[model samples]
Target: MTELPRDRVRELLDAVLDDEASDRDDMARRVYISPFHFSRQFRLGTYESPVALRRRVILERAAWRLRRGDSVTDVALSEGYESVEGFSRAFSRAFGFPPSAAERTSTHWLPAPNGIHFHPPTSLWVDSAEAPRSSMDPTTQMVHHDIDDTRYLLELAGKVAVRDYDRPLLPRHVVLGWDGPEESIAAVLEHLIWSKEVWLASIDGADVPARGGRDIGALAARHETAAPRFISAVQRIAAEDRWGDVLIDALCDPPESFVLGSVISHVLTFSAYRRQVVRQMLRNVGVEADQGDPIMWLRTRHQPSHER
Candidate 1:
């Protein structure tokens, strides 16, 4: 079978995520592909049929809602199941537990075959396991790899020429999908640091330090202080295996709740994307920034010079 383009698959997956009520036919129509071809391509690319993927995603959403205290009947109806019994049967098959049991125990559900996972009410992303593990066990060392690269990127950003530090390399609307008062390189770096603090505050319920202004030095220093806190938090979470604890985020107007593991995944995803943005911006301004590829970082950090 011919391999489908990854970008096209991502588009289709995003469409499915946007509307779980949409059937495979609707999805094919939206993407302007025939249902037969779309189904074949989707299955080949994602290791699951389009319909199966959508159902699994919807069921995962249902599990998250159930954990967040939503009634099983309401979640069932919202997810398009006609009755509680039907929803319960499907939920049990997908997650190995009924909706009520999931709500009571509040355990972590397995990720989708495609590696796309959700954190409830909001937040979804394709898992990119590009970073190398510091140890054989992923659960223990993934966060350390993230922390190391985060600090490295911040140090590289600090070396950008002073005049170009605050220059607008990419518009805020393009980078963040919305307009903001500040759209400079420095603003992106500050936002990167500030985002971690936000997640840290949500995880620990402690007062975080104020965001460093446009000064890259100050931002680096603030990040140096904040990065360890996040490392500690992740270590603690990993040690206790509390990846499924529900966290109520006070930052949202209605207050959003997400599984703790999802929040950590969100942090890793956000950091990876923004760090590359900063690296590219630095390169644009004539700084000889490393490519900032996580794998390359790992190779340089681990293997000796004469290994090859």
Candidate 2:
């Protein structure tokens, strides 16, 4: 595994998080790289595009300040938003609530594909477990994207009515034969969580876990519980270089065997399919969801501006 040079990554991160650095071109200039290569290298190292990381961490700071009773206008202006209304809209979109509601949420940190976030007073917090210790592996990137995207979809689904949630969006659609039809948003989301639960159980040699409820909230809770375990399990497997290792699953009738590598691959393959299905279902039901593309999901393209 090739790791990015820490010094270069640190320098790039410093440029990105600098209060004076607001544009990708400026960040590129600071790092003495062209904007295109800078963005690419930053994503390669940080698992997030520079602009998206800056924007999200800034909003995270704004959320923290708002929670501490900072005026929305003050925080908004300090965070570079031109107006309080603009700030509120962005805040609401990112946090799922207005600035005024910031005090109600426990943590200001939003869901980041990379674990980079605002950490108190004036610093960034990177979760060592979530952020790759080595170079960003393609497998790790996809796994992180899949989990984060599923969580994002669940958040969007939580706002829809139960009737619409259960409405069939695809006729006769089924990914795994035994999992049954995944034609509705609820069913797709259910299998998304279940796939993790069942696989993890088999991996751990534990009994098959009970299926979670179909409610978006319940599914969200189950995901919160299952996602980290799934990530940790994958991380452990990778750290031990156990991808090619085989496992005997007593959970399967008369027992079955699987290579760790293929197990995760299978889950990721179908989870990707189900995620897009849910996204389309959300759009059809009058809720907006992203394109669910890994390219788009992992990075954002910012307009060029050489403000430095």
Candidate 3:
């Protein structure tokens, strides 16, 4: 697949936004390509049709102007809409609200697949960060909570009597079929840390990680090592927009493949369940285990200790 060079892509984009370029035919002429080829190239480069991108960028600009207290009629006429009624319809469809309400919106940017958005003062802002900008994004929030809660459980497990830590109190508690039963605090905690180690190994293309020590100190050590690496791997995947990329695991008897996104989801799902299991196991041993609810975790995490 021949991809457009960045310079050429910029040139074509510039031509599309040229003030005198009235339509697709005019845009193609400015770029010295036939209308058909220009459309094809533009779509291939930006994953959007030229006309559609133009309209979106225009609406984005209108949104920016409106949020800054520009009159709807003024913005509508400046963006080439024939009337305020037509502009209102387009704005409502693109932004899910009338232009009159733009001042109340938190952001002016809409969902865009290509990451190309309108820059202030007549330019394009190409966002290279494909992932959510905040650490509090849902996936990252869950990952942080999982890591924190797991470590807290390990600390609680360390205080349990050695016999209770190893006792099989929860009967027939199985999460994944292949990992077998997790009926003891030791078993559940080990699985919780070990699963992340295994997945990180697979992601790094290293040989399968050797099963580590199952004691509290050992489990804590293993988790401390793997937790940051796991978070780094997920961040890299998101930054590169590689969630759909596949990993072929030769460690499987017959090689198996997994999508990167699904792999993260699998780890988070099972880890969440195992965290609760460990909490219950702690309670069974007459230890105080926090509720382990993310809602509570987030609330307590952000609020002042005095308020909590």
TM-score of 3: 0.56
Model 1 TM-score, 2 decimals: 0.51
Q: Write the per-residue lDDT of candidate 2 for residues 1-308, one digit (tens) a residue.
A: 99865566678889898888869899999989898678656755665667777888899999999989998889999889999899989899678789999988899987665567899999889877556544557887788788767867887898888788888889899887987888898989999999999999888788888886879768976786577568778888998999999999898788888999999999999999888888888888899987887787545422222321
Candidate 3, residues 57-101, lDDT tens digits: the string is 899999999999999999999899999999999899678799999
Model 1 Cα lDDT, one tens digit per residue, 1-308: 99965566577676566664367788888777777666645543454556666776678778878888889889999889889999999888667677888767654444443456665556665554312223656643455555555556665666777878887777643444432534567877777778788788778675654656658667755665465557657766766889999998786668889999998887777666777777777778777676766566456445432241
Which regions in candidate 3 have their CA more than 4 angstroms from the true location? 1-135, 305-308
* lDDT of candidates 1 onward, in order: 0.66, 0.81, 0.81
Model 2 has an lDDT value of: 0.81
Model 2 stretches with alpha carbons more than 4 Å out: 1-131, 300-308
Alpha carbon lDDT of residue 62, candidate 2? 93
Worst 10 residues of 2 by lDDT: 299-308
